[model samples]
Target: MSQSRRNFLKAMGAASLTAVGAKNAKATPKNVLSDDRFGVLVDTTVCIGCRQCEYACKVEHDLPAGNIDDYSDRSVFEHMRRPDHTALTVVNGYPSEKDKQQQVTVKVQCMHCDHPACVSACIVGAISKQENGAVIWDESRCIGCRYCMVACPFQIPAFEYHKAIEPKIMKCDLCYETRTSKGQPPACVEACPTEALIFGKRYELIQIAHERIRKNPDRYYDHVFGEHEVGGTSWLYLGSQDFSKLGFPDLGTKPAPGATEPIQHAIFKFFVPPVALYALLGGIMWLGKQNREEEE
Candidate 1:
């Protein structure tokens, strides 16, 4: 209320505004910059669950001969299974009443979600979303905390518990080392003699999926899983029955579990806070120096 008090408050307010303005001057980087590379699109309508793909994955990866249940031999078919620490990919049998014996075999592995949560979960930057959209993990950088497994909405990433010596995060890296990096198709797609698993550009795969549904409406489900669901996966699926009945949950068009980076980006206007802090300190120190000079 007094003149001196009013002037002091006004100066403080003006200083804050200047700092805020300075902070806002920098541009923020966008998090959703997608890559042009493509990936395998599993057309579930065609997979027969021959286990050949699983076999190929085993030989290629070169693990112990056979798993206790299946991973030892990669017999994902021996039991209805999901991809785990040992098995990178598993073909599960889907029995639909609409097309009985359609016996749709869906190959379960990393969907390689476009906006991946695994990448965000890792404190060491061990998990990365590849250019082709395959979400891969680097063991060298991993701490084996298993947060990635927890962060994945699909529960795809698995950890290697077999080794008490030095276990690590274990899951499909989209066969990056063995095939994709060489400009060749993945083992699963290659092993499918029936052309069930098709690997190619993501957009092209969606077109192929729609084509199959249109050709035989009675044989295939009208919807294509992973095309838009969970912000779209590099790998996709099709089936005679609804995806949910076959264990695929009802997911939204939004990016799957590990894709919440946009939310982070919005909150962390990276340079803004630092710049503002600097401006405030600069003004404070400048004022202190001015006061000392006046005293002198």
Candidate 2:
């Protein structure tokens, strides 16, 4: 084949592959909401600010876990904290609206949304909503895009900014790989002394949350925090006061990706844009060559 023809063929082949990749990147996976998927119900009202869950999480993930007794320090609760790279979960203390002397503790972690924005935002399918109700991240597939961090409504995904090599997007995975996949509760749930975090089926947890609120209306805020927020979540919450006061975002019933996915699908539907761009580039090359030959 002629040099110009060979070059054209190579360029077209690369463009086609690029186009295919673009289409696949935006393709939404089947939204899985299994009836028997496991979940954790966090009773903020029952938490004691012990921070055992935090310690357990660190140990489980092989992070820099300090002495277990160190978690007994209630002073850490003085300032509100969120989950970060060092700790996948953290407990924060909030003043009880009902009682002046008592404080309510809330364990913060990934909500593992039923319709995860991270999974949808990922350009490389690095994040996935598992059948077991865990929104897990595959480090192997992650290209350090940090889209998951931006997409999360709870702002749960944490990036390892300090690591120069293979920095990770860190968050709670509900022990899917280490425990739950083997039919065991997460390290945090197992460590809670007060049973504040209950691990069970997602549907069952919702039922249990409502039952608690129904039986003790005065103790609960009359709403299960994660039951419907962003189209529900695997990590449910029950609190004494407004969730907003406890540092929870007030989100709507619609899933975070609902507004954007349709538009994305439309744009990438037939891979028309990539193919057109490729063809246009080829035409430009051909025209340039023709003009040069005429002058010669």
Candidate 3:
């Protein structure tokens, strides 16, 4: 082959490879972050049903600071309560099978998932996963679509339904702007007297969870709740019994994004191939016309 022809073919091959690489890259789902992101480890056995974490979360968020003493009432645990606009976090009591009189308390809030479904589902880009492992919402960017609430596997996001105007989505932000950004632990973690909640780097917390489980196999179940659920979350949990009994959903290790991305990609790919093919043909036709014009 002529040297020029060989060079032309090589250039075309490189361009085709680059195009394929870009397509494959876009098709792949977002990967898990391996960086030094913050996380929390919750040992359910250590939680003493004090509800101090709930009170601290309220105070930190500047919510109704009703007498802190009122939070001591265990009657609230009679029925399940979730995090709402007024409260960013809630501590719930589950009847302990070992002791019928005693109830195990577990704090509920946004899990700050490594691959957050809320971030993926937000049509207006209202929700985002922070570098420090916080899944946060921007009210200014929100159009009140409420798609995020439907998307979350944990059902963490709560909407301000009472407000007639300018309602905002509410959820735990991992205290990113208030404490975590300033190198401080979350208010709830700080308030836990029993050290039930351990706040640190995600990887470090996972190691600690494993160590605790290994040291006292009888005390805790072998599984670390957030290590692989929905492609891993920043909030880790250790339970003496099955997590499902503690009100945690039994989500398999498969990432939630896997379900949504394929449909979305299929729609995009359906349109993209035709558009790209047209552009390529148009370019070839244009080149041919230019050559003819040159000869004329």
The TM-scores of all predictions, comma-separated, are 0.72, 0.86, 0.80
Candidate with maximal lDDT: 2
Cα-based lDDT for every prediction: 0.75, 0.91, 0.89
Give stretches of model 2 more than 4 Å off. 1-31, 286-296
Which pairs, if any, clash in model 1? 66-72, 66-73, 67-71, 67-72, 67-73, 115-259, 116-258, 117-258, 230-256, 231-254
**Candidate number that wins on TM-score, 2 or 3:** 2
RMSD of each: 11.2, 5.2, 9.9
Q: Candidate 3 lDDT, tens digit per residue, 113-165?
A: 88788888887778988777888899899999898999999998999999999
> Highest TM-score among the candidates is held by which one?
2
- Count of steric clashes across candidates, in order: 10, 0, 0
For residues 1-296, what per-residue lDDT tens digits would candidate 1 score against the true structure?
45798899999999999999887886343333344566676767667667677767776777543642342343444467878766677778767676564566678888887877777777677998766556678878888888888888788887778789778787878788778867688887887888888888778778888998899988888998888877777878878778987779787887654355655555557777678889999999999999999999
Ordering by TM-score: 2, 3, 1
lDDT at 56, model 3 = 91
lDDT of 1: 0.75
lDDT for 37 in candidate 3 is 84
